[model samples]
Target: MSLRRGAAHGAAWNFATAVGERSIGFAVLAILVRHITLADVGLIAIASALSEIGRMITTGGSGEQVVASPGDRTVEAGAFWAQFILAAAIAGLLFVAAPVLARAYGAPALSWVTRVLSVNIILGTFLVVPSARLVQNFGFRALSLMSLGSTILGGTVALALVFSGRGLDALIAQRIVGITFYAAAASITARWYPPAFPSLAAIGRALRFNIPMMGAAFVDYVAATGYVVLIGIRMPVAAVGEFRIAQRLAEVLRELTVFPASKVFLPVFVAVRDDPDRRFAVARSLVDVLAIGSLAAAAVAGAVAKPVVVLMFGVRWASSAPVFAALSLIVPAAAVYAFVNPMLTALRRPVLVSVFAAINAASTALAAWFAAPEGLLILAWTLAARGLLTAILLLPALSIGIGRPAWPLLRLFTAPFIALIAARVAAAALVPVLVQQSGLGIVAMFSQLAVGGIIAASVFLGTLALLAPRRIGTLLGQLTSAFRRVPVVAEPVG
Candidate 1:
């Protein structure tokens, strides 16, 4: 079949895989929270963030290079060797930083936790090329199955560890297991393996393309999770845990709604890169769907953020609700990256993307530095507002990539913005009618969340349908056809 058909199939499988795996992942979090203390959560959050920064830096450009080159054995070997080398360097850095982190947080456990995770990152290096190869060939079906298996197996191991009174290990072990499964499974599925030796010249070529992406990815991750690091430093331990939960929930909504399309955007963009008119047209369509879907998801999540947080993580995490809402408000704005970055990469504009991410990262870090000491809610809103600012700042780059003025892109979010506001307003308006007390029972909170999410979403769709029927119709059309079954990747580009 055609690349268009393959992309739709990839989107379908990716969406399904995201839903299934994240559903289990969510359950794992909900379970872990009950048994795990806030202090332990804070410790792990800091460690995870640090190690993950390394992963983001090393893998960002290398994998994209693999996908861009397609079936180039030399490039694949170079990417793997490059990622592995970076992982090693980062692991060494983590080892050195471990003590500093422990002292900074007054959590001695972090030193060992950070050390263990350093090793995990090293093991994780093996997966990058295989994973990217799957994407190169549009083999998302195999990747999807591997993802589900990874999540399930990892979650199982985690729960067992937790029940056995090892909550910290549970959390870390889950990631390790998941990575191991996916790395091995993807390699098998793609029938690709690393060569016996490295290619210095190919590595140089890959680095030229990937170095800017490394900075972009690193800064972009810092923009999102930098608050946790700031909180761990400036605020109380419990606040770190609360913010982590809030971030996790916001991420869940993002993974479900925006990322499915994002997973396929690179390949799609690459396929159409040579045709400006088709490229811009495709970019426009995806951006609209991304904006609207992201807005709707964020609206509903924001509307029910309170009850959902309470019910899911227990009343202890109720404080995270406001934080989630603050973060949720920026979903449409932040979702811009999911589309824009991939588009920029396909357009050979990684440096521009780096600038975009750097500005956001700097602004967010500045905002957090001031806001963290004030309070969690203050920090959250500060970061949230910065997310919108990032979107505003990114429009010029987006316009340049598509060879259009910024107004057309700016106008795309108008209806979705309206719908998002309407949904939140409608949900808030129903609270007094539905909730009588803060100390309500579990069933009551469940009812509130269910009713609130449903009505909020309904309002969003109704507003969109009323305001822009044709646009809404097109978005719906994509969703409906996005599920037609087909082979994940029939052939490779090379």
Candidate 2:
């Protein structure tokens, strides 16, 4: 019952924020596309991406430490302050050095972008403890409201800026404003405050756990962002923008798909962490759910790749179509990781997981660097490889105490993949027939795509239900319940 309540609220908040932000974000992108060059947008992407790397490196494993150590308020506050100070210090130093870092990357325009994004670290610092407390208390509903209020504030400001000709400055300002609001809102919602001084002992313990987790987060960011950096340098901003759109669209689909399952599963993991039998049972159920959810999402993403891209971003972004299709494959792999990786953290093997993340990041970055074309295809291949590597590494670690996951569990993914392939083929076939000509008006193109995608999604969903009723049934039940009270949305993965 606690799980249901928490999840219900979390999903509601996630959904509202996701829908509002994404809709307004796409609008922001559309506005920017009309006003700025692709290169400018790409530079913004680079700055944001690099800041995430820095943030992860600075904060380290504090979050996982908090997660692992239950009900330790003093320790939690200590962890928050330590991470906050470190993140703020880094942000300050980085602000001064942003110009040099941009020069090092051969994109001097990124200096301002970097400086602007640095403030996010400070904003994030203030909110970390509060946000953590909310999640800790399972007050997802309140969390959702806080997040939406911030998002609406930010999105509204962004829209205004775009219309006022702020260009990419709108992007930077929107983030700062949004984070400020979010932090303030979450702080109010959680109602937990720290004293003037942080506990040294608590900081020490948090660092012990968080450093490795931070390392892992750093690697994850690097891996995901490496391609964007490479493209920014080797290709034009337009190309980078196209690629970013693909990545973003893919992630949106991923988040929407997994929100329901994760909410249902997080408390389950926390509860069964100490019970091997129950842990394994929960793990199996989660895997089944993830497989079904992921594949189903992938299918729809694949089917609508062309139409969705054109529908949302306008005709200029048609290049993103294939990239979206390529990225669609990584959704299932990410879903798998979401379940396995968290389980590892809960098992107190965060270091091992961090190591895995580092290896994955290194290999992915290397692959991106080596794959010179910088096309979505290469990016897709790199992500798929990373996903495969993560799964392989996790199986052995998870199997250690639980033996092996049931073999038949693998079969659950078969139907969804098949549906995805079929949808792609159908979309590919329909694109030419419906579109017939290139460079038509954006509306006409998107209309054709919408028609094609709806038809394809219907086929995909219907086929999955017919072939895998159990999975379909589980998904429908969650969706039904999720909408009944509040929308429970997932975090975007791909």
Candidate 3:
């Protein structure tokens, strides 16, 4: 198959998988919130955040090394052993530091929660080789389906446990079950077994990649989770939970709308690295689709957040509406950074990526420190606004990666962004007028939704069409062609 076709297939499966996984996650979270206290959620959020930091550290180290390395030696063997060892070390550290973490958070229960979830670190490494090989081979369909299946099983177990009064255990159970199932299924699908003999040379090469990658990963982790850490410092546990939920919802939307291309783009970029025209075409495609899709998601989220919150999370979470809306509105800006990071990776530019990530991390930390003192809602909006403010800074980085000007990429997002702003303003003003009950009941929720959602959808579409009809046509044609000539690959996992 041609490289572009493979990328398209990869992107489609990635979108499908992201949609399915985040949907299940949202549903489970909504249900869990009903059964648990805000404090409970907050406690788990801290523990989960720490676990995520560990996962991110390990993720940057070995599995991705296997994906990035084009090998003469058995890089997979080295990567497998590298990740397994790293996972073990992180797990042990988490276990040992659980008490200190609990003390820092002033929650004794956090110790056990961290310890329980630490097992996931060890369990996660088991799939390193299988998952990497699938991604390296453009087997997104299989990988996507596999992840979706694991999510379904995990969500089912979580629901059952939540109903059975598992509380914090229920949340922890979901990750463990999902990782276990995904690892086992991925290994089976890929039919990959670790070698009995180790390769010292392969290990050295993998480490060469991993060392820089790990630095980038650490910065990436700080940028991603610094808010959680900094906010937790000044806020109560309940406030932290509320903030985490709003951020989580926006992040899920981001994965669906902004980042489906990220998973597909790294290898795609590498494949076309030597061909400037093809690589630029891929980059342009990313800018167009990611910006438009993200803007659309943002518009809807901003307009319908109230009614969606009412329906899924009840009036208890009404505060999250504005926060979610604020975070949602910044998707287009966030897309620029997301799109550039992978391109840099493909160009073997980890140091540059790491430097940008450092900038992102420092900015996030400062933003959180300033905002957390005011209120959670203010902090959410601050985070959202900074996304747009700092996004422009990435254009130079992209220009460097493509060895071309970044002005044209901005044009692709401009029309959609303008349309989004107008539609959102219209939707925001209309919702309050149409919904008299103030989103307290199902009838009122639907009323707000009907006015806001319809206005947002219609205005955004009509305005985008009016402004960029030809570009829309071209983008649609490209997307449609992607679904054609897709080859079936058995024994693949998304």
Candidate 4:
């Protein structure tokens, strides 16, 4: 298939996967909240955070290296063995350190929870090779089906356990079951067995390529999960739960808007790796499109965060609304960063990407530490600020990668940013009027949110259409062409 057609297919499947997975996850979480206490969720959050670090260490950019490399069975096998060994080691270390973590947090239950969740590190090792092969071949349809099935099975098991009063164990069980299913599905779909003799040279090459990438991944882990760790350490366990839920809601918007496209772009960039001009053009175009969509979605989500949180998680989580709203600003920054990072990586600039990620991680860690004492809202704001700082730090690399001045990129985003601001302002005004007119029952609150969202969307699109008419027209044209079933041509091999 042509690069365009391949990308479209991959994006469609990824979107389906993300939507189904997130929907099932939300349902499970909503149900679990009803059965579990905030402290329970917080405990799981701490365990999950630590496990994420181990996961980063285990995967350590090997999957991306595998995906970008040529179809070499030796390299694939080497990557598999490397990942498996590292994952096992990490799992063992996590198991041994679980009690120390529990002691640090003064939560005895965390020790066992951490130990149980550590199993995912090993499970993830089984998934890396096959999953990377699928992505390399653009086999997103199979991947999507696997993801959806795993999500459904996991959600079902989680709900059953919750009802059976398994408490936090239910969450751990859900993840373990989900990863197991995914590993099984990936193995079947790829249908490739590991070679008995993995090449040491291939392993060396992969490790060399991955060392810088792993540094970036580790930094990313700190940026993404460090806040939860800090909160768990310095604040009440309930506060960590609230912050985690808020972060999850904000991330949902990101998953829906930017993640699917980024997933598609990675392989596309790999295909066009040899052509700098083409790579730059593709990166710039994706940045423009993702920025417009992601920021607008973020604005709408932030505007209606209160009603959405209450509606999804019930009135008990009302306090989480502001946290969600504050964190929503991270969406646009995240979208741009996601687009830029893969483009850079595909162009063999992992070290540059690592530098940017390091700066982001360090800045965000400091911000989170300072903000933790103030409360969740301030911490949420800190997260937003971290996103902004990341974007700023990334500007130079983005300009170089795209072969354009940073100003043009900044200019491209101005319309969307302004539109988002105007939308929020409009929503801020409209929501109060609606609330005053109708009492704040569930129905009224939803109505107010609906009206506010409608107003915000209208303002955002109207402003975009007025300010960037050609860009809007181009997007529409692409959509029209996509629906018309254009002929597929094979992508140029790098």
**lDDT tens digits, residue span 36-120, model 1:** 9998888888888888888888887888888888888888888888878888998999899899888988888989998888777
RMSD of 2: 4.3
lDDT of 3: 0.79
After superposition, the stretches of candidate 2 with alpha carbons farther than 4 Å from their true spots are: 259-266, 372-376, 381-390, 397-403, 406-409, 434-439, 474-494
Model 4 agreement with the true structure over 1-494: per-residue lDDT tens digits: 77777887788788888988898889889889988899998989889888878888778677888888769787787777777777898899999999998999989999999999998988887787888899988899998899889888988989988898897878988889998999999988999666675678877777777778878887887876655887788898888888888988987888888888888877998888788777766666667778788888988988888888887888888899999999999887778678666777888888887888788778878888888889888888888977876787778877766666766665677788889988989898878876665543698668868887898899899988888777776655554555456743222211
Residue pairs clashing in model 1 are none
Candidate 2 vs candidate 3, TM-score winner: 3
Candidates by TM-score, descending order: 4, 1, 3, 2
Instruction: State every prediction's TM-score relative to the real structure.
Output: 0.95, 0.88, 0.94, 0.95
- Tens digits of per-residue lDDT for model 2 on 1-494? 44545555565566665666666666666666677667777778888877776677765556555555667777777788788878978888989999987886677778888998987876676776777666666666676667667766776787788789887777777777878998888877777665466667777877777777777878866765545676566656667776888888877776666654554344456667788876765566556667766776777677667767776667777778877877777777667556644666777777776876776677767666666365666766667666656555555555642436544445556787787777767767776777665665766666666766776787777777777766666655654664465544432111
Model 1, clash count? 0
Q: What ranking of all candidate models by lDDT puts the best one first?
A: 1, 4, 3, 2
Root-mean-square deviation per candidate: 3.9, 4.3, 4.2, 3.1
Score residue 475 of candidate 1 by CA lDDT. Answer: 64
**lDDT, candidate 3, 66-121, per-residue tens:** 67775523778877766677779999999999999888878899899999988887
Better of 1 and 3 by TM-score: 1
Model 1 poorest ten-residue lDDT run = 485-494
